[model samples]
Target: MSGSPLSALSWRKSSLSGPRDVCCVEIAFTGAATAVRDSKNPDSDALFFDERVWNRFLLAAKTGEFGPN
Candidate 1:
């Protein structure tokens, strides 16, 4: 993922973000992986996750596994 060109991917930010918002994460979906990068630093390396791991992480997030206890 790091070697490939991220500019080719269709990165998208959350719709909830306003025009003035600067702090947010952008995501791009690929055939084999999902890409995540900071909207404020688009040139930085993106985090890539395969389908299974990404889905698991999403489930955990939805279940508040990352929330404070």
Candidate 2:
């Protein structure tokens, strides 16, 4: 769950997100942490992984760790 930092923060979602907005992710930079959320349901709760963890996730993603055939 997120704290007050995410309350009034401005979020930035990937521009490549489809028009349907179903397959989308949103991230907010609050200096100390990064907030990730599902664009399909902005009001729903979000997950806050440490920035280091987030970077590791990104590295894995870039290397096709979650890729398909």
Per TM-score, the best of the predicted structures is 2
lDDT of 2 by residue, 1-69 (tens): 345545577899888877888689999877777888888777777788788998999999889999872
Candidate 1 residue-wise lDDT, 1-69, digit = tens: 445689899999989776865778899998889999998888899999999999999999889999974
Candidate 2 residues lying further than 4 Å off, grouped into runs, are 1-5
Clashes of 2: 0
- Candidate 2 residue 69 Cα shift, in angstroms, is 8.1
**Residue 13 in model 2: shift from native, Å?**
1.1
Clashing pairs in model 1?
none
Q: Give the TM-score of candidate 1.
A: 0.80
